[model samples]
Structure formats: C-alpha cells, structure tokens
Target chain A: MVERWPIVGMGAICSLGSTARETFDALCAGRSGLAPIRGFTTDWYTSDSLFEIDDRDDSKDRPGRATGFLLSVIAEALTDAGLSDDLGDVPVLVGTGLRELRSVELWRGSGAAVTPAELHFGAAVRSRFGAWDTHTFSNACSASLYALSLATDLLSAGEADTVVVAGTDSITESMFGVADRVQSIPPDAVRPFDRERRGTILGEGAAAVVLRREPGTGGSPRGWVRGVEVNCDAHHPTAPEAGSIAGAMRAAHQRAGVTPADIDLVMLHGTGTIANDLGEALAMREVYGEDLARPVCTAMKSMTGHTSGASGLHSLITALQSMDAGRVVPVPTLEKPIDEMSGFRLAREQAVPVDARLAQINAFGFGGINAVTVVEGNR
Target chain B: MSEQLFVTGIGVALPGADHRDAVLDPQVPEPVDPAARIGRKGLRYKDRATQLALVAAYEALRDAGLLSDPDDAKSHVAVDASSVAVIAASNYGNLDSVAATIDTIQQDRSTRLVSPINTPNLSSNVIASEAAIRYGLRGPNLTVCNGSTGGLDALRWAGSLLRAGRAEHVLVVAVEPDNDVVRSFAGTPRALDGAVAMVLGPARDEVDTKRPPQAVLSATQRAATIDDLLPRLGVDLTAVDGWYGPGGAAEHGLIGQVRPIELGHDWGTPSSVLGLLQCVHAAARFAAGATGTLLAVCGDPADGVYCGTLVEAPRQASRALTAAGHDAHR
Candidate 1:
C-alpha cells in the first residue's frame, strides 16, 4: 500500500500574516492584504496594488527578503511540530512556481560581487537552511504542491523517514512589470467568482510543511495530505484547461480512495480572473457531475490575493482553520456569483457552518499546470 | 519498488546532432535552428530553449510511435493523448529570453516593445508546457530544476507517476540553450547547449511493434557522491561497459576514474540529459546479443549530490514481459 503522509506541522509568511495561524485568522475575519506596493517598485509600471509582505525593511536586497521569509516560516513549522532533532539528512524539496525572485534580482542587479551560487536561488536556500540535499521544483504556481507531491513520494517509497516540503517567492520589480504588461493585475480588489471581478493582485509569501511517514492515521490530528494529483493542459501556455483540471481532481480522489461525493469543501484557484473562475467551475462540475450533494467552496485569494507559488499552502492552511472553526470562510466582494458556478455551494458574505471531512486545495498556473491536493481534517 | 521501466525511445537535438537519422558529430557547440527542423508554425514567439525542447520531444514521440509522421504531428499521435505525461528538466532555465527581454527594455526604455504574450515565457516550466501543448500530452506536466540530475530525476519522476497509474506513457525532455551571457556569468569554459528527450513505457507491455527495449531502468535515487552514485547499481563500474558524466565544477576527478565510453564533453547541469543521449547512442551500437550496463551520473555543487540511473542493456525487459505473459496464460 502507498504510505499516507501525515501533516506534522505547517508555517507560512504572507501579506495576510507572518504566521499561518495569523493568516488563517485574518482570512476568517474578511481581511484583504491588497495595498499599494511598498517594498518593491518599478519604473515602467509602478501603480499596481499588490499584497506585499509589509514590515520587512524596504532597503533589504532580494535574497535577504526571500531567505528571511522562508527561514521564518520553516522555523515556525519545525517548532510547531516539536521536531528538534538534527534535520541535516532529512529530504528537502522546495518549489518556486515562477522564476526565483533572487535569481531575477541578481541577474538584473548591478553585477558586482555576485557569486555563481547566488544566481541559482535553490543553492542559496539550501545554504541558508542547511539542507544540503534538496530538490527544487519550478512548475509555476503549482510548484510548492508539486514539491509536496515529491516529498510524499519520498515518504511513501520509504526513501526518507521525514521530509520537509517548502515554497517561497517574493514579488519583484520585474514580476510586477510583467504582470502589469500582461494586464493580470486587478485595477481595484481581487473579487473571485464575482461578476465584477477584474483580476488578481500578485502577492509575496512562503510556506513549509513537515510531513512524517505514517500508515493511515495514528497520531494527534495536525492534518492529513491524503493525496495530490497533478496534470497539464497541453492546451495553452496561459489558459487553464478544464479537461486536465478535471483529470487532476478525478486522479486525486481516486488515489485518496474517496469518491467525488466524499469531498466536503473546496478551496479553489479562484484568482478572481474570469478565465480561471469559469475553468475551475467547469472542472468541479466535471468531477462532481450532477450530484445534488455538492461541496461548498471558498477562495482565500479574495483575502490573501494570489501568492503565486505559495498560494496552494495558503489555501491549505486556511482550510485547516475552517475545519477547526467548523465554518467555511467567505470571499469578500462575492456579491454576485458568476454564471458558470454551479453544482457547488459558494461561501460568501458570512462564514457557513458545516461538518466537513475532506477538503481539496486547488492551484493552477501558467502552462496549463493544474494541481489538486486532498486533505483530511478532524471533522 | 514498483514495476520496471524500459527506455523505449530517445530523441536528441544536441549542438551537432539530430535524431532524425541519428547523426551525432559531438563537435563544439553551435546554434541549431529548431524552426528549420520542426517547422516554423506557432514557434515564432517561443524562445530557442522551448523550440529546441519541442523538436526533441516530437522526435522522441515519433520514435516511440506516439507520432506517426513528422509532417502531420497533431493527426499522427498513436498514444492516448490524455494518458501521456510530459516532464521538462533544465537547470539554467530560459535565460536567453529573459536576457533578451531585459536587454530590449533597457535599450528601448519602453515596456511596450515587449509582447505581453512573452510574460508566460519568463517561467522555466514554459519549456515543458509548450511540449505538452504541441504534443497533446495531458498527463502530469512537470518542470524540474534540480541542478545536475534534474533530467534524470525527471525520468524518475515520470517512472513514479507511471507506477502510481497516473499515466500510461511518459515523455521526458531536457533542454539547454546556449547563452553567451550565462556562460560568461558562470565563467565556465564550455558552451554546452542542447536538448535530449526519452519516451518511457511499461516493461510488461506488448503494445508496440519494436523489440522490448534498448535498456531497463532501476529506481533513481540520490547518492552522497560519485562513488556512492555508481555503486548503487549493485555492481562495479569497472566491470560495466561504460559511464557518462555531466558533472560540473563540483565533480572534477570523476571522469578520469569512470572512463566513460563516450565523454559528453559538455558542461552545466542540463547537459546531463545530453549525456543520456550519448550513453544511449553508444549502447545501441552493442551487438544484439551483447550484455552491458551503463551508469549515467549528473551532479553539480548547487545540487550538492549526485543523481544516477542504472541502465541494463540487452536488458532484462524481455524477462518482465515473459513473466507477465506467463501469468496471463497460466
């Protein structure tokens, strides 16, 4: 049997909060991290509001920002899990869905005293975290979850007893310029699934999870990553392919030994972009078919914006909060649901109370990359 | 361990090589026109890296019977498009496009000059994404940047996905475009830039027209060093037929010790996949009944470990098929 991976600890740093718990609480309270860019600026396109990780010194270089963000969350996760033993040999996998901000910065820097390793952001992270052996996944927004998938494979295959799966990316001037050029940034707020939704606001953040090899479940309930399914569109570079998205959902459910009817809630890749909303809604329908018993859905992108590579973990942690609170958090400004949203309940305005047992965190990105991870809560 | 895998087909688009007729000069690096070989439609906007990967991926697919002809690609796919996975591996990424866009903006001082369509090109995964789109491979599309072994690890990743029943077949492609800027930035001596692709299938299958396979692969794992990497094959390399090294500055003395049959003479981590092409080419030269094993190692300091795969030729692939058929008949 494939070994089940138990979630021992979780940590995150984003504009929503510096800690995962804080981020969860803020989302539950309907707080949005959208604001004018503070730490980063661009000349060609400067006014794009973003969910910037405030509080870090503005003058800090690119590597400093990214490294500090990653280490802070990893420390929190390790502490939360009570794993104090040496982690020198533990298998490590870090993912950056997009290009590493530091690599972009170093390349776009003044080109002085830049070491060769600095050009490879994965090496810098390895050096700082002392994870001499780590695999880096760079599959766009689904990167961290892919990293999670790799870690799960390691644990299931008995290659490692413990594994650290982490992801981090800070918005850079270049990133901002690209978003602005592509017109992906919203003019106002990120209103996912709303008729008035414009687009998503790019954000900066990091997330890490400590996964221990376990059979099914025999430990204190931190959480359970039952399984994750990944697939690609083979359709478009930027467009979300509902067929593959549906394929991933079906694969994840099949691997988790659960039927579509077993899903209690869904945290979608609701980037507030109409294309993504329509695509995801269609995929959900494809998975659930015409079943009357459909799961309620929520999106933290309304609160935390699009954290890019770190968005999947943010949604996972947020769902964990809902499981603990016994309420599905609502998306702000979701006054009118889009026409494509059907077969599932949309959580908006106020949090909805429900006894949810299984939840799926969805992350989709450029290259038609789709990832669906099933998590078991203490419901 | 899950079911064994066979290297059913390989596609290579190296600097002085082409997989069309299997001509490999292995000379100094030079630019190759992917558009010329693969056609120019829909490729005008892509980077050299993406184009190179697409060419290699198509060749590999054709070699594996997934594509019937080079002239008619979309109509010729023989495998289930929905059940095929694609994994693109690279270490340097598409620096050629990044540098080009940055240089253009610097020169023009206007972001307007850069096409908005190019925004997606900033990602390293774009190479794999393009391959999937062009080839209609909807299975687990992955992009790996694990230093030297990213290429092999991609093969390993595909193997695991296949074992888990995620896909029926997997296409693994690795590409590195020659960038003078990156070469000078690293102060490396070589201009190694090319792409290599492989199509892997289950060992127990009698689905295709070709022989079992050129080689069968063991599980891919991370080893401490070159010493640990090769021995994991459960045999001595001196007794084996050959070795292939895509090691960078981190693994200096490894080549002199292993004495590879065909020295890749390539630098950088992505070239490890190119080394794979070299190894496969040499193994194909073996007499039909000849038996041998080739150890392919790719490592870099950034990766901090060697990732190797053990390939057994005149491989035990037939044994796996026979056992499966025996069970079926019994």
Candidate 2:
C-alpha cells in the first residue's frame, strides 16, 4: 500500500522575488528574473551576465566576501512555510555541487582567514534553528536533488518527523573560472531547447522545503514531496550518459507507481548547453515515447539560469508555486515555439492553464551525477 | 515497522594481518609497528588504499564464509569508495601527497611533478573502483562523501537498498588510509588506518531474530542532533584512546571491551583502524554473549550522526551449521 504523504510547508528565493509569495506572484504574471550580470567583477571572470541575487536588503548584510545567495533563498523558503520561527530541531539536508567556491576563492585571493564552507553553513542553520543533524553533499550538479532523495528516504524510514531539504550555490568569480575552464558557462542569456542555444548562464539562488509526516500547525501546505531517485553515470564525470539519465527517471517513476505518460509536465534540467539539452530530449523521448502531444515541458533555467546546486530546488519552487496556483509558468524567451531539432513540446509567453497533476524535475551535475524527482498533485 | 537486517559476511584488513582470525584474535601480530621494515616492506608495492581494502575485504569475506568461493561475491554492494569511508577514521586521504604537492609548488613552480600517487590516492573513490575490479562487483556502486558521517551514511544507504529490494546482498565497506592533511590539521585524534566490511542481508538466523539480538539495528532512529547525541552517548572528544600519542580521545563507552591494539605504539601514532577493529571486536563479543551490548556510533563531526547497537544473543552458535548448508549449495 502506498503511504499517504502530506506537504507541510514550503519556501524559496529566486531571481523573480526574495519571498515565496513574491516569486509566486511573478510566476503568475509570467515575470522573468534574468538580466545583465552586475553582482561581481565579471570582466576579470568569464560570463558577462548571470541570475544574480542582489536586490534583497539582507543580501548586502552578508558577513563574508562570497555572499551565499542561496542561504537567503532558503530563509525565504523557511519563512514561507511558517518554519522561520519554529524549525523545532528537525534534521536538515543541504546539497550543493559547489560548497561556497566563491568564499574559498575570496579567502584564496584576499589571504583573509575564512571559515570552511561546510562548518559555516551548519553553524548558521543551527543558530537559526536548534541543534539538528545536518548533512552536506556535493555531487557536482546533482547535489541538491540528491539531497531531496536522501530526505525522502529519511522520512520514509521514520528517522525524522520533519526534514528540511535545501540546495544553494552562489555565482562567484571562481565559479566562472572553473566553468570557463570547462567551457560550460554561456556567453550571454540562456536559451534552453532553442537551436541557437549555446551554454548555461550561471545563476545564484537557494531554496528550502519543509517536509513533515502531517500538516504543520501553521495552517495549509502547498504540496508534499513524493518520490526522488539518484544515480551516478560513472561513465564520465563531466558528460552525462543518456541511458543512465533515463534509468534514473524510470526508477523514480516506478517507485512512485507512476508512468512517463502519467506525467503532466516536465521541468527540464535544461542547462542551455547543446549537449545537455540534446541528452535530456533523447532521454525524454526514450521514456515518454514518440507521442508528439505528451506532457507540456518547460525550461525554467532560461529565466533563472543554472543556479548550480540550487537549480533543482530553485526550479522545484517555481514548479510547486505553479501547481499551487493552477497554472504553468511560461519561458523567459522562446523565440521559436518548435525548434526543428526539439522532439518535445515547449511552453512560451504568459502563464498557461494546464492540468499537469504529476511532474518531474531533472538535476544533473558535474561528474555525470544525475538526480530525478517526481512530484505529484493530490490525486 | 521493524525490518530485519542480517550480517551475512564481513571483511577486514588491518595492521596485524588480512585474516579474520588474525584481525579478531586480539593477539597483536609480531610486526605491529608502522615504521618497522616488516610493515614498510609492502608499503612500496601497494598503495595505502589497496592495502586497507584488501585486508578488510578478506576478513569480511572470511567472516561471511565466502573465502572458498571468492567469485560468489554476489551478496554485497560497497557503500563508499573513500579510504575514510571504507577503512578507518584516522587514515583518510594521504597527507604526504598534499604536503609534497604544496611543497613542490612552493619550492619550484615549473619543476614540480604531479604524480599519480598525488592524484588518485588523495580522493576516496579510487578505493571503490579498485575493490570492484578486484572482486568483480557490478551492482550499484556509491561512495558516501558526507565527511565524518561517511561510514554510517554508507550503512544507511545499504539499508535503503536492501529494504527497497534493490540488491540481494549489500556489502558495506568503510576504509580510510593514512593521510598527511588530517595529521597536520588536528593531530590525528583517534586516527588509524583500517577497513571494515560487512555483508548486510535479511535477518535469517535465530540470533538475529531473538530479543536483545546480535547487532540490533534500529532503522527508525530517534531524531536527535549531532550535538545532543554525542553528549547523550558520552563520546569524549578530549580523552583519546587506541592511538599512541598522548592517548586521550576514546570511543564511546557503549562499545564495551574492544581490547584495542595500539598499532605502531612506538611512533606515538595509533592506527586509525581502531574504530573498525573495535566495531568488529564488539560485534563478535556481543554475538558470542561476551558483552551485554555494544554500540557503534558513526557521524561527521561537522554534521550527521548515525548510531547502531549490537546486543548479546546466544542463538548465533547455529551459524556454523547453517554455513555448511550454504556450502553444500555451491
């Protein structure tokens, strides 16, 4: 028998807004968060623009040089879920492919003493809440999505009544340096699924979702996390293998007792890279079949860019808000509705009305680590 | 709601030797010192990762009674490939490589050589790949990288796979080799080099089913933070044990009567293998009803903590007879 899982609370901070409500409003109005990069010294770096978070007031109050934009996004998620005041010492799982690479660079460049990213993150969370068991995972880009999978397992095993799952990564000069070295960072704005798409524009943000056995005392919940699956390609650390990516998605769908056809929408990892988008499209086609009119798919990364480790959770928040609002958020810019090379359907323009009860989110990171999470509406 | 998890096999490679009897006997082998020629003789040919895993996998397979049919390694999946994750807490990644790499760069930028020893040995995943190739394992492979929590996290991951029916026999290995970075950073507390391998499967034997069972693992753990759990378990971070230098830090008293062997006692450095050694020792003692209860608490000092307890049970004596039944099938 399937267990009845309930959504207690949710939170997020993305390019569109600092608060969950604000982000949801933007999503409803089909607002975009992408713009020219101005947060850091980009001339000395690689990419010219990114999904930087600097509008928020507290974003300026960050103590260190490499501001963990994701932490603020997590704070927003906690507040939205009514968990800001009362976290109640629950276990916290945070995933990031890059654990404060920016901070590490700042320390390296300035020669200033800095706290290790892992300890600093834990200390900050514990101070906000009480002492809680914490785990930080860095599995390339699949980090945060893998965190979600771990949280689900913990909750299913009854290890915790409530588990807070968060994924955050900041865009810094060092991130660009690495991306530039690898030739993965884009030259301009993101264009996922487009024929002219080049590469992923690095983005920064954080997201946290409070998962509990029952609805929290705080009132109504948005949606509950259902099934999540993770797998390593072990094929190539940098490039993803289509077979394994498809296997991961299938594993999650099977575990959830759902099918590819049952999915209402798909939140593509859509890193804006030609290889990544092509790999995802091939995987989706293999899993979902040749039916042209299948699940409505959209790439949120076009607006938010790739939020590094936080991209999974960042897109999840946007997808969840859409589920809550009963609409599908449109793409930031889809110049062409049907790219000749694209095999799946893509959504464009303002928010569209759709009945996608079940959806999937893909987060594939460096090292060929792939994590797929299947989210469903109340059946 | 309780699921039955069984200890079908175990592997261990320690300072003393790579045999189950040698590892569990508590009789220190003649060449116990790390610096002695006898110990250093093999250090040149084998990478520290290979030595640690080979010894641990041998002991585990012996304890599991899979030595006769080494190719019949179908029952277990390795949870981590990290040296620390697979072997011991102290012998994490090699520190000498880090020191040398940094030293070379500092001394002469263009003259430094980036050796293979400096590359693969520094990362923990090499051990997993090596073990897989050595044992011919093709099942689900994962390397838990949650710092100190790697050991327990590996166990948890194995448990999930077994419960989910993903694998019939899951081999959970935690190995750590001696490293230089850890030594300079914190003086290598109870650090030692060793590997602990366990075969996790469905509880079958009478001892596993009995109350106060041998190695009773509560999948549904109590929700407690790392800070609170450590204090409750009485884990003394200050007064170390097993290691030679100063000899202050100690494992939780819950793991009663381990008869720890201070490997390389003269060097004032204890082998990081003590934790795995102690775990195997306590589990064996508990199974034999020599101890009332024993607990192996694994966690990352920075984050997650997992606690596992083993209780005394006399019914496990029948395991020898059951071993024959499985042997006949092969």
Candidate 3:
C-alpha cells in the first residue's frame, strides 16, 4: 500500500454558505441549495430546482462570467484554509468540469482573444497568493478528485509538503445548453435516489482543500483521504461499464487498506440522472452484497445540485463535517428508494446514529472515468 | 519499494511508417515528405490529439511486444487519465466542440452545435480514456494535464503507481495533437504528430514470463527553475553527440551543429509525442553503438525549455558511442 497521506486543510463553496462552517450548518438543517431556474430560461426546459447561488453580488470589478464566480469561491476557500493565493512552491492543481466557458464563448462569438492558462490559474496565484506552482485539470466531473489524488502523490513522494487542490466550474449559457442536451439536468427540485427522480440541476461553485504531509498542531482531521483509486470502463466515451464501477471502488479500498465494513457511510455522486443513480447503486451492491444493513448511502446532489467537478469535494466536505459533528446525513430527497437494489442502508432526514468511522465518496464522469476516495476521522 | 520501472517494449507510428522498433539510430524519420499520415481517410476526421494518441498507443503496445492481440493490453490501466480527473481532460472536450461552437456562433445567429463527442473529446482526459479503450486497460485509468510537463508527467504518474503497489502493470501514454488553436497559441509552424507510450512495472528478479523486461526508473526531479537542474545533472554539453530540438532558423544557433531534428516538421503540432519517440530512438541508437547519452530538449519559444534524457546501459546503449567514434571529447 502507498504511504498514508494526510489532508491538512479544506475549502468549499456551493449553494450553501461561502464558509465550511456555514455550509455544514445549512446541510445539518437540511437546507437545499436548489431554486427556480434563473441562470438561464426554463420555459420549455424539462428540469427545475437547480443548485443556484443566492445573493450572488455581481458588483465587483470582476467580469460577469462563470470564472468570476469560481474566483470568488476560491478566495473564500483560501481564507478558510489560512493560505495565500500564490502556489509557486506548492503545486496548484485546479479541477473543473467545464474549463473556461468564457474562452469557448469568445472563440465561438468573434474569434476574439482567448484567456491563457496563466491568466486563469497563473494569474489567480500571482494575484491572490503571490506566487505558486500551478496547473489546470479539466477531467469533467472527476477532475477535482484527480487533483486531490495528485496532491497525495506529491506529499507521499516528498515533492511538496503542502499542496493546494481546488475545483471550480461556472454555470454559463454553453454549459446549460450542453446539460440540456444530455438530459442530465432536471427542470425542478433536486431529488437523488427518488423513484421518480428525473435529472440533476447544474450548479456553479468552487471548492478547495489544502493537503499537507503533516497537519501542524492546528486543523481538524475529521476526514482524511485514506486511499484514492481511479479507473475507466474502456468501453464507451460517455457511459461506464457496470462492472468497472465496482472495480474502481475495490481499487480505492485496496489502496486505502480498508474494506467495505470499515466504511461508515458513502457520499454518492448521485447526478440525479437515472443512469448515474442506477450505476452507483449497482456498484454499491456489487461491493457490499445483499447485506441491506451495510454502509449507509447518502447523496449531496439534492443539497448542492450537481456541482460537476466540484461535486466530489462538496460531498467530501459534508462527510468531513458530519463526521466531526457525530451524525450521518440523510439522503435528503429519497421519497421512494428503489427496492430492486436491496442492499445498503439509506439515510433519512435526521442523522443516522453510527460508530463506524470510514466513509467513501464516489465521483464518476463522462468517458467512463471513475474515482473513489476513502475518508476516516482522525484517530 | 522504489525499484526501477523498466521500458519493456515500445510502439511508434510516425509520419513515414509504423513499427515495433525504435527510430533514434537511423535519425528522425527524415521530416515526413508529404506528411502522409496527416490527411488520410480516418486520420482527417480525428482531432490532432486523438490521432497523436492513437498512433502512439498502438505503436507503444506493439513495441512492448504486446499489441498483436487485444488480450495483451487487458490488465493495463491508464495512468494519465486520472491525472486531471475524468471527462474534463478530453481532446473532444476542448478543441472540436469549442471550435465548432465558436464557428457556429460567429454567424450572429444563436445556433446550437453541441455534441457528445465534444464533451468527451475536448476534455484533457480523453487521451487516457481512448488509450484504455484501444488497449483494453482495466487497471487505474487516469490522465494528468500539466502543460509542457504532460509527457514526462504521464510517465512519472505511471511510475508512482508501480512504486506504490497500485497495479501490477500500467500503461503510460502521452499525446498532444497540433490543433490550429493550440498552434496559433504556440506561434510556431506546428509540431510533428506522434505518440509515445511505455509499459512501467516493478523491477523483478526473474522475468515473470507473464511480463516484459524491467527498465528501472532510477530517479526524476523537477527543478525550482531551469538553472537549478543544469549543473546538478552532470550534463557535459561539450561532449554531447546530438542535439534534438525545434526546427527552423529561429532556433538555429540555440545549439550549434547538433542540427535540431524537428520531429514536428513532418508531423505538424503533435510533437510532444515525438519527445518519447526520440527517447526510443536514443535507446535504439545506444543499443546499436551509434551514439551515447542523447539530450532531448522541448518547449515553445515562449515557455522555457524542458529536457528529457535517456541514459543507455551496457549493450542496449545508444548508437551515439560508435557514431561519435567513442570520442570522450568531440
């Protein structure tokens, strides 16, 4: 097994509050981040109840775009982690589902100037933290976790003692248009694992986590990355083979040196799309078997709507906070859970009482890319 | 646990031909004549990224003596795919979709040009996924996009997996297509199209018969800046046999007489893969006693240069030795 790497700090932004504490409180109160479609028109759109940022101030000198939103949230996350914007010494690994939609729009509109990578991450580091080593990761949904895993490698390999892993994606017209086409976004209400669930609502936000080899005397160790494993179906560009989903989970557990029994709960990617939900359920069943009393499964999509690349961290942040608070988050909108998938425990509105310390967060995306990260409270 | 991750086999498909051998000994495939690989039937439809990766993945597996049948690649995992995350690192995700959408939008009309291919392909991760599908890799399919460092970055990521006990075998593939957008950004005549892949696994006492030879990865370190690595690497520039770098008069005096072989000259844009191809070439040459210790430096005029070296051992040494008359000082 690879040496166990530690997660020294974390940052997150979603429909919830800008701070980790605020977001955690909102989650405990079961506050959903979903709302009516305002980012774009939904007159004929089939989905509703997307995770939208409320009271988003567009008055800043920042241009009105997805990037602006990302920068704002990243700023808030950096503050929480007690880090500057510069990432020179530390590798600044940024993840996003849709990278620079503004660049895409400009390229489409007037063939205008495109933003350089420096302008994005490079400039962000220079302007915010002062100086830093940086790189951008655009792997669809699993991008952030990939960044986290890389951070683990850097620390484990002694490349850097500390690394800043951040994930950000903005909601733009092009983003919605694509979401509309895929039918992954729902018209209203974010409901995951609901028998009548339709699809996910695209949400905009950024999340950051400061990973260090040694967590100085400060910081909470509620949720540390035990092991991270990534896999592809090698089958299709957009869909994952059912068996490989399980393979990915197995690999994560193997790397983390833990088992399904060691897991206390699981944060499902739960895109709210039928295929995604079913696929996740099948993977859980494959790994946990018919033991319905096994690891409790919950999802954050209802609370955060689909954050895309940031979804993994969104779930991770919630798991970390919930673990510290000594509670299990309910599967927010599971009106009627599927019966055919007759294994695994499902969380209700109130936190499920449990003593198990381990948790698993599953993030899968287009091109059949899958990553599973194991987390446990600091011993 | 930090054993050598050997390069058992290699596969390469360049401008002129496809082979399971290294091309370094003969000299960079004389800049593709008409660049025959460029506008071919299926090749035209593929984005430069896909084409570069396809060629390299196919060739790398072939070189490792494993591509004859689909089954040989089954246990392999894509180490680069997980580098960034998932679908975001796709070639279809970035170039094709954005380019098409941009083209359609410039018309002043609100035209929609979204396709599934765009989302999966433009993404930086697509190269890794495509490699997995092509080779049927079941273990650790991942991708990493760190710019100029991507090629070696992919190699290092695979090497880590081997060191950490993640997989028994891993496929490390790096391919960059020379898209018009990327080329214009680089402000160059476009690099050659190519792909380079290496099968990395732990060093073994006995060749398990189930696996290939073990090429140990001694060590790799990135400098805080270019200067920090130069003198520390023990590189004796004066004793060098060849200098493989960019083409054109602009880069002429950058390194004297070494005659920079523009692998991109014939290939156009996807030259990153050529770096690996160059490594294989050096390996073959060293094996043939034609040259010794080859230095491959790659970078855009804008960004600083990044160097990759292939140190040949014993009989497998590059042809540089015999070619340079085994001169201690040339």
Task: Point to the candidate with the largest lDDT.
Answer: 1
On TM-score, the candidate that comes out on top is 1
Q: How many residue pairs clash in each candidate?
A: 1, 54, 88
Candidate maximizing DockQ: 1
TM-score (second chain) of model 1: 0.82
Residue-by-residue lDDT tens digits, candidate 2, A116-184: 324225545655565345555544466677778767776676656777888776664434444543453
TM-score of chain B of each: 0.82, 0.62, 0.67
Clashing pairs in 1: A97-A140
TM for every model, in the order presented, reads 0.89, 0.72, 0.80
Error of 2 at A326 (Å): 3.9
Clash count, predicted structure 3: 88
DockQ of each: 0.38, 0.12, 0.28
Q: lDDT score, residue A177, model 3?
A: 55
Task: Return the candidate ranking by lDDT, descending.
Answer: 1, 3, 2
Question: Alpha-carbon error at B160 in model 2, in Å?
Answer: 3.8
* lDDT (Cα, tens digit) per residue for candidate 1, span B192-242: 577888888876336554545656765665565766554444444454455
Better candidate number, 2 or 3, judged by lDDT:
3
